[model samples]
Target: MKKSISVLAATLFLLIMVSSASAARFSIGGFGGLNLPIAQDDASSGALFGAKGRILLLPFLGLEPNFCFAKYGGKDVDDVRGKSYTQEGGDITSFGADLVFGSMSSMGKMRVYGLAGLNSNTYKREKLEDESGLGVAFGTGFEFFPQEMLSLEIRAKYHAIKVGDGGKVHLEFSGGLNYYFGTE
Candidate 1:
């Protein structure tokens, strides 16, 4: 019995080490693209930009932390005659984390990820004041490494939230390059 227990413990330890060794990566990247607002009274699609840092826990899994800023113009606010119009616009900032999955291969890395985080939006129109909410984000992208030290990727994300009576959902997308300053 004692011998069996010892063998089991050693086997488990070995397996853990091997798995850890197979799934380790770290990267930093940035993105910029467009945000298309849906089911909203203002703004069509806006420009967005952001940065991110990632740490791979397993070769196929990683944790990514990112922040984005976006601005849109085209909503109507309170007019000169004390009437509200829908011709004004606004800016929004989002900070979030994503549990990333997919393989990093020599042909380039492909990933599908889910995001959960917070967002703060400020509107230029008085009727659409600033608001904040806990949001859910999901997106996918790929990285192509032309050089060992640099990579490029383009991704699209969906951000949605339920706030009081004015909930919002938007499609966010970006394309950016990354520079790996440290050793691989």
Candidate 2:
């Protein structure tokens, strides 16, 4: 886990350094929204929050580095005797990078983009041991620029992680704001 994080950090640093020279635009943003579990009986829907930075390496390609935290909702279950119990929820902390493909120049004030990424996720629960896993994520988003320096954005993403012999999958819907740092 430590080694993976170290490598991810080094790669991000190198990308940022390279982007400083050839990138046409840069932005930083924060987001919050819903985290909905898919086909999972042990957990329910919860919340998600994150921060991200983007570097446009070309007119149609960009890179995003991000960190996020998400929570699972507790589930209510019944034993064979028909007694009910509430299961404890879990949370995940993730760090990843995405390759974004889109035209920076927009039609009117809006731009549409798609992204795919790899992430390292740390999952924690009340009674279970903490586990770390590598995950994949894919998403699409709309960005609305209200002014030269600010953008309003909304996105929907699918994330999947494998742990032990099973896996977890979720859908994340989010809204955010970004402040640009370079010429767009």
Candidate 3:
């Protein structure tokens, strides 16, 4: 895990250094939405919030660094004897970076994009040991620019994380606003 994080940091640093020379635009945004656990019996749908920053490296490619916090809803489980018990939900805090590719042109008011990224996630829950793992995410979204310096965006992403011998998977749908800095 340490080695992987080091490599990721180095690669991001290199990309930023190379792209900074020609980067034309930058933006920062915050989003909030629903987080739905997929095929999981111990968890239910919850809420997620995050912040992200975008650096345009080319006309159709950009880099985004992001942080997110998500909650899992508690579930009611039935025991072997038909007794019911409550399974408490957990929380995940993630930090990651994404490569965004799409049509980002000034000629249109709307831009569509696809993104893939990797992240480090920390999981915390009651009665279980806390753990950290690596996660992967891929998604697609669109941005609508209603003004020269502002954009309204909506996205849907699939996120998966490795846990102790198993894994957790979820889908996130979010909406946000971005404020652009420099020429768009």
Candidate 4:
């Protein structure tokens, strides 16, 4: 926990320093949504929440550091021996950076973008050891800036964690509000 806190603090400081100097565009936001599991027969839909720091390097390019947590819904099943078993939901936490493309639509009130990045993911399950590994994440989003410094955003994200023989793939649909600082 201490190590994670330290890394988060350092990352925030670096982002602030870089953004302050550039004075281009900087924002902080948080989101929550549904985490839907695909191809993983044993897993079910879950709750997802996350936060991000966004730094726009150019009008059409940006960098985002994000953290997310998702919890799976519970399931019950019986083994091959016909023994009943209660299966609890699982959870995952991920931290990562993304490269974003596109921004500020022609209408001037909307921003649409796509992001892809690498993440450090940790998976936890009931009655099982926790697993940690690297993953890839990709997402698309649209934000509407109704006010000068505020935006309402909607996004869908996909993650592929390399843990099992192949990988664990999941998708998340979410909404958030962001507060921007600095100039355009």
Off-target runs (Cα >4 Å) in candidate 1 are 1-24, 76-86, 105-129, 181-184
Best by lDDT: 3
The better-scoring model by lDDT among 1 and 4 is: 4
| C-alpha RMSD between model 4 and the true structure | 3.5
> Model 2: per-residue lDDT, tens digit, 1-184?
7787788778878888888899867899999999999998889999999999999987888899999999999998879488989897699899989888998644358889999988889989998899998788999999998987899999999999876667899999999999888676
- Comparing 3 with 4 on TM-score, the higher-scoring candidate is 3
Give me the runs in candidate 4 sitting further than 4 Å from their true place. Answer: 1-20, 78-84, 104-107
Error of 4 at 160 (Å): 0.7
| Stretch of 10 with least lDDT, candidate 1 | 116-125
- Best-first order by TM-score: 3, 2, 4, 1
The per-model lDDT (C-alpha) reads: 0.64, 0.88, 0.90, 0.81
Better of 1 and 3 by lDDT: 3
Cα lDDT of model 4 by residue, 21-111, tens digit: 7656678999999999887767889999999988876677777888999888776676759886657879999887777789632337888
lDDT by residue (tens digit), candidate 3, 53-119? 9999888889998999999999999885889987888989998899999986454889999999998
TM-score of each: 0.70, 0.93, 0.94, 0.84
Model 2 Cα shift for residue 151 (angstroms) = 0.7
Error of 3 at 22 (Å): 1.3
lDDT accuracy of residue 177 in candidate 2: 96
